[model samples]
Target: MRKLGTARPISQKQSARKEGTRSLAKHHHKSFAKKSRSYSSTTAAMAQQNLNSLLQWSTENTVAPGATQPSSDPARQPAQLDPALLAQLLGGPSDADLMRQAMTAILSPEMPQDQKMIAWDNLEQLIESIDNAMNLTPLGMWAPLVQQLDAEESGSRMMAAWCISTAVQNNVKAQEAMLATGAVEKLAGLVLGDADQGVRKKACNALSSECRNFQAGMDELVKSLPEDVWKGKAVDAAEMDSVDEVIGKLREIAARQS
Candidate 1:
C-alpha cells in the first residue's frame, strides 16, 4: 500500500533481480542440506571402524598377547583362549614351551571338556612341531594327570590299543617303541575276549598293524581268538554297538583279504 498521494514505480529489471536472489537462496539451502547428510554418514562409518579396531587391540593386549608369558599362578588358567593366540599358533610358533603349555592345557582337567577335545585335535599340530626334536614321545611328553590312555579299565585298555596303533601308523620308530612294551598280546586278547566292542574294534585295528608288521601278536589274533567274539552281548548297548559293527566289518574284510 502506497501513501495516499505518493506512488512508487517498479522496474522490470529490479523485480527480476529480486526473484533471482530468492531462487539463489533456495538452491543454497538445498545444497547445504545434502552436504550435511553426507558428512554425518561418513562420520558414523569412521566411528564404527575405530571402535572395532580398539576392541581388537584390547583383546590382543589383555587376553592373549602371543608370546607373552602366562601368569605364574598354576591355578589361574585363561578362562578362554585368546583369538590372537589361536591365530599365532596356527601361523606357527616353534617355541617348545608354548607348544608344551598348549598340549598340557588341552588334556588338563581344569579346562572345559570341549576345549580339551579341541586340544586333542591339536596334537597332530604339536607332533608336527616337535617331530624333529625327538624320535619317540619325549619322556614326560604328556602327563600322569589323564592316564585313561594307560589304565587297565575296559575303556582305558581300548584307548591303549588305539594309542599303540596310532603310534605305529604315524612313525616306524614309534611302532618299534610301542611294540617293545608287549602291548600287542593284551590287544589280541581284547579282540578275542573283551565284551566291549570298542575295546574289540580298537584291538582289531591294533592287531591289523601287528599282523602287517609280522609281529607274533598277529598269530595270536588269527589262531587263538574265538570265532564268536563278535556275537558277545555288549554291556553298553548304546555306545558299544557302533564299535561292534566296525569290528564285524574288519573281520569280513580280513576274511576277504585272506
Candidate 2:
C-alpha cells in the first residue's frame, strides 16, 4: 500500500512538471511575438521619418523659377546622403515598386534634371544586382528604357545605355530580354552616329554586353552593325576605335561559340 502511494505521488509530480514546462514555452512564445510586432512597428515608423526628412531636404534645396542654376561643382552641390543609410530608410518597398518609382521619376516630363539624375542613379545601383537585372523585363522596364535610348538629352542617352550595360552584364536571361526590346539596333545606331562622344562610349559598352555569348543576340547585333557602316561613318577616330574593339571582341566570342 505504501509503495503504491509513493508511485502515485511520483506520477503526479511528473505530470505537474510537464505542465510547468508547457506553460513556460507558451509564455516565451508570446513574449517573442510581442517583441517582433514591436520591432516591426518601430521600423515602419523610422522609415516614414526618414522619408519625410528626405522630402524636406529636397524641398529646401529646389531651385525656384528663374533662379540661378546651382553650381556644377561637387562641393557646391547638396551633400549626398549615404547610400547605405538611404537603403535602410527606404527599406520595405518591394523590388518592383522601387524600380517602378525610379522609372516614373526618370520619365516624368516635369521632374527636374537633378531629380531625374538621382532617379537614374538609383536605377543604376539597383541593376547592379543580378536578381534585380533579371527582374527588369517582368517589371515592365524594358520598353521605356529602350525608348529612352533615343531621348534628346545626351545625358539621358548616356545613362540609359550605361544602365543597359550594367543590367545585362553576365546575365544571359537579361541579355535575351533586352534584345527582344530591339535595344541592340538602337544601341548600335548610337554607336555609329550619335555625335556625343560619351553617348557613343556608353552605347558601345551596352552593345558589347547585349550580344556577348548569346548567339541570337550576336546574329541581331551583327546585322545591325554592317561592315560598311564602320568604314563609311564620319565618327571621330577614338569613337571608331571603340566600336572596332567591340566588333573584334564579338567576333572572338562568335569564333569560340561556333
Candidate 3:
C-alpha cells in the first residue's frame, strides 16, 4: 500500500485568503468580458455612423438644391432651385413672390408645363434680385452659387444663360457686377457640353452678347471662338446659328482685338 500524508489546514485566514483570490480572479474575468463587449459595441456604432454620413453627403451632393451632379443617365440631371433667389426670400417677404410660390406649389403637379413657365418667371425674379441697384455685395456673393446651379440641370441652366444675356444687353451695371466675379467663365462652363442643345445655344448666345459689350473684357473669349468647339462640334451644332455667323462674329472679334 502507498503511504498517504494527511493534508493540514494552517488557519481560517489561509482559507479566506484563497477564497478572496478566487473571487478577485472571477471579478477580473467578468470585467474583462464587459470591456471587450463595450469596445465591440463602440466599433459597430462608429461604422454605422460613418455609413449614415456617407449616405447623407451622397444625397446632398446629388440633389442639394443648387449643387451640381451629372446624372447616371446622360439625358437627365437633378432639379434646381435658385439659391440666390431663395436665400434672398428668406431675408424678407416679397408678397408677389410668395403668392407665386404658393400658386406654383399648388399647380405644379397638375399643370407641369404651365408651372414650368411660372417657375421660369420665378427664376428671373431670383436673378433680378441680385441686379437690385443697391445690393452689389449680395449679388457678388450669389455668383458662385448661381454658377454652381447653372451646371445642375438644363432647365436651370436655361434661366441662368438667358438672364445673363438679357443683363449684358440691357443692364450695364449688372453686366459689370457679374463679369467682375468671372461670371462669364462660369456661364461658359455651364453651356459647354450641356445635355440640352438649347441650353448650350443659349450659353453661346449669352457669351456672344457679353463679348459684344466691349467694356466687359469678354472680347478675348469672343476672339478665341474657332470654327469648331473643342469637342469638334461646329458652333452651329448648338442648333442656334449657322457656322457662318459664329465664324463671322469670331472674325469680328479678331479684327477688333487686332
Best TM-score goes to which candidate? 2
* Predicted structure 1, TM vs. truth: 0.38
lDDT at 19, model 2: 31
lDDT of each: 0.46, 0.68, 0.46
lDDT of 1 by residue, 1-258 (tens): 111112122212122222322333344446546777779698578657656765675575464435555588655453554554553334333334433543454445665543343333333233443252243346444333124344444544554455455545535565555455556556656655566767677667765654454434334444444555443332232233554463465555434321
Q: How much is the lDDT of residue 135 in candidate 1?
A: 32
Off by over 4 Å in 3: 1-119, 125-141, 190-192, 223-258
**Clashing pairs in model 2, backbone N/Cα/C closer than 3 A:** none
Clashes of each: 0, 0, 0
Q: Which rank order by TM-score, best down to worst?
A: 2, 3, 1
Once model 1 is optimally superposed onto the true structure by TM-score, how far is the C-alpha of residue 252 displaced, in angstroms?
A: 6.2
TM-score per prediction, in order, is 0.38, 0.56, 0.39
Point out the higher-scoring one by TM-score: 2 or 3.
2
Indicate the TM-score of model 3.
Answer: 0.39
Candidate that scores best on lDDT: 2
